[model samples]
Target: MAESDGQERTEQPTEQRLRQAREKGQIPRSKELGTAAVLLSAAAALLMLGDALGEALSMVFEQSFRLERAAIFDPATMMPALAEAIGGLMWPLLGMFAVVLVAALVGNSLLGGFNFSTQAMMPKFSRLSPVNGLKRMFGVQALVELLKSIAKVVFIATIAIWLLWSQFDHILRLSGETLNLAMKDALELLLWMGLALCLALLPIVAIDVPFQVWNHTRQLKMTLQEVKDEYKNTEGKPEVKSRIRRLQQEMANRRMMAEVPTADVVVVNPTHFSVALRYDKDKPGAAPVVVAKGLDEVALKIREVAREYQVPVISSPALARAVYFSTKLDREIPDGLFVAVAQILAYVFQLNAWRKGQGNKPVPLKDDLPIPDEYRV
Candidate 1:
């Protein structure tokens, strides 16, 4: 569906998208960097352990050539000698291999860290398609890889040739030197050559690392619609969120209406607004709190609930609207409207008292209640 949109991918990927890609083992990695590191590590290991390696190799050569009368006649004796010779050769090589392995792992980890994912190990049949294979072989990525390979070859060859040419005089005189001196000269020359090659590779690694990162980021670019879709997936679809909000409002209204029966009075703006106020003499607040409030149809419902529960319904348009707008449900009415609500509550109490024949009938509530001018609207 996203591909069908034909939207150009321009935006940088979000963190979630990047994280998903990482989980799938799709992370920037430069093969050149790992190759260079392994090469350098192997060269360093050989240089550091040169004496020990030479001794091991000499032992292997000596063992292979040394023939005792028993070793020459007995095949079983020969097998043990051959095995000892092989073990001598393997030790130095194994040390070099270990160094190379460590270097390769460190180089790869420097860029993308360590991520073990089976998703990358899974094979896809699409890789077998000729068209896809040709595209991969001749694509921009392939072209870039070809260029990098050519550059690396040229750089290494140039360094090697330059080093060898500079040491040509020394090389020609090697035949006149003692065996130990000749061996030392050759070792030094090889070390210099290896160092030169390693240095040459540094530039290629520098360029390839940034190129790999850029290519990976470009491939992960997101279209505008994709961003919106991802947002919806992570947050919620707009319509679904709206429906949820509507359901929450309905539930809140039901709960508010349930509180109407316990309210001392329901103040109304005729048929438009309604606010149910409740006051507890033992509560800390000095004024009544609005327990329920609604507008229009909800107001009608509040009034009906109030009547059904025999709660007093007072017509106070300004006070009702003011309380409904300014006060939150289950919170005390603002100080500005305290006097007005107090007078209404006093009237309701008096009416109740009169109904039970305990007090004189209260006068009708005045239109001009003690509501502040600012709260009039």
Candidate 2:
């Protein structure tokens, strides 16, 4: 199991952790699986190609002895004869090599798929330290490898002893047979023994493959603190994000409060809600826009700023609540409230005129202004 700061690693690795491990060339592999696959493939190839290979060998042997007495003494003729013999065997050897090479590649890729990482290829200077080297030499992995080697040796030895005991009579009969018959018999016996050894490896491969996968996962497991650390690195720390959002909210509130002073009228629910609207006279048909709005404490602050700037403060409970709930800052109030807001704006204009002694005093505004049912909070 993996450990961090004396804490046992108990959590499964995350996708990011697995991906990073792959990037570092850490992946599960079973040497026994690869060995079994290669051996089995070699046995299969030899079984299929044995006749042709045997024929080639027979032909080479026949040619080797068919030389004239005078030609055998000639160096030039000897070299040519040896070259022909070697050339005859080359294709069969190459064919078997190809099959074994493919088997090895396919077997090794069974667990981890294919990965090529430069970091895996790079040598670490830390590995050269005597202390590190000693630890590795006596590690759990080394002990496991030693046990596997001993098991393999024992298995092969047992198979060899059984084959020798069972084939004692056949071996004696081969000695009395003709050279071709003896060679054929020997080849068949060897192929069957090779197949038996390959079969024995199946159990080891099955056991080792699962062990390698489990060991790899155990090595990559994360501790609780490590998981938390990784989360902070990847998704960011929660408290820091909370702080940032708070700062952002404060900045936005400051900007909204600044707009409150510039509003034409500050409509209020008296204590709980406040919505400030501004009309553009230059755009004659344009609806009044909500410049600032707030609930409770923010509402009180907006009202304070409005008084400081000498903006008109109207106590219209329904209208204030409707605008506060339905409209965002700097957006026009909904069409349903257009008539109600227009009435308020007209009263403000007339009251301003009266204050300057330019017109008669306007009538007081009504409390039950029109508010859409859908917008009612």
Query: Which residue runs does candidate 1 get wrong by more than 4 Å?
Result: 1-6, 63-77, 176-185, 242-377
- Over 26-63, each residue of candidate 2 has an lDDT whose tens digit, in order, gives 99988888899999999998898877678778888789
Q: Candidate 2: where is the Cα deviation over 4 Å?
A: 1-4, 239-377
Provide the lDDT at 332 for model 2: 93
Q: List lDDT for all candidates, in order.
A: 0.87, 0.89
Best by lDDT: 2
Cα shift from native, residue 149, model 2 (Å): 1.3
lDDT of 2: 0.89
The TM-score that candidate 1 achieves is 0.62
